[model samples]
Target: MPITTSSPPIRQPCPPGTCICNRDALLDNPAADPRILLLTQHEEKRLLARLENCASLDDLRKLQQRMEQQLGLRTEITPGHNEVRSMRGIRIVVHEQDGLCRKIRQSIPAAIRRGLERNPEVAYELLNEHDLLRGT
Candidate 1:
């Protein structure tokens, strides 16, 4: 069996004792206004953020929720939602950017180049500086 949907049946008193129009007849009339599909409130906010360039971390999280529904993997997680939100998504390589870690598994070559330009001797000492900075 297939389910059918139409205008919902509403009970209204017949004026002056005339019978009310039957529900089946009302269902035959077309709807005055058709429904338009809409993005969820959360999704709309996310797109605005990307356009407006002022989205907070929390706003991104809401957008992420929507993307996770459609695109997936907007941010990396430590395995669960924290008590707080943080900036995540689309990793960027800045002229000088490195994760703070106990040991430098990856080196900031760009930063090293800048340092080298400052002093050729310092460029030669880049690895040594990393070892020293990590206190290893």
Candidate 2:
């Protein structure tokens, strides 16, 4: 009897300007990139509200951990030394090689607008509570 083995199939290159290959690559290793953390509008609103409700650095830290656990997105919160009651800075770290960071940044304004349109008073209250609303 002759010994024979089948060769592995070759992968064809994806067409130009198409994301078929990229999508397949992501499907193969979803955990390799944090771009999966992209949030829907509803999720963004809920997260923003939760952020606004944080009363202290401890609260913010807890929220950060929750986000990391639930969304796979890492965040850092920095409280101002002079202002013990407020979070002065927040950084959301993610892989930027694939433009996910820019996409998230660009979506913020639209999300806030939608939130404001849905409930102006609640939106204002949340933003003001977090010292994000100017001249309030």
Give the number of the best model, judged by lDDT: 2
What is the lDDT, from 0 to 100, of the residue 112 in candidate 2? 32
User: Model 1: per-residue lDDT, tens digit, 26-127?
Assistant: 335465211111223354344434423313334434544664454322332121133212122112121211111111112222222333344443322333
Span of ten consecutive residues with least summed lDDT in model 2: 83-92
Model 1: weakest 10-residue lDDT segment is 96-105
The TM-score leader among the candidates is 2
TM-score of each: 0.20, 0.41
lDDT of 2 at 131: 80
Which stretches of candidate 2 lie above 4 Å from their native place? 1-25, 28-35, 79-103, 106-136
lDDT of 2 by residue, 1-136 (tens): 9999985332233345643225345546756653333454457667777665545445555776776675555543322335333222222233233312344443433443343445445444544566865574
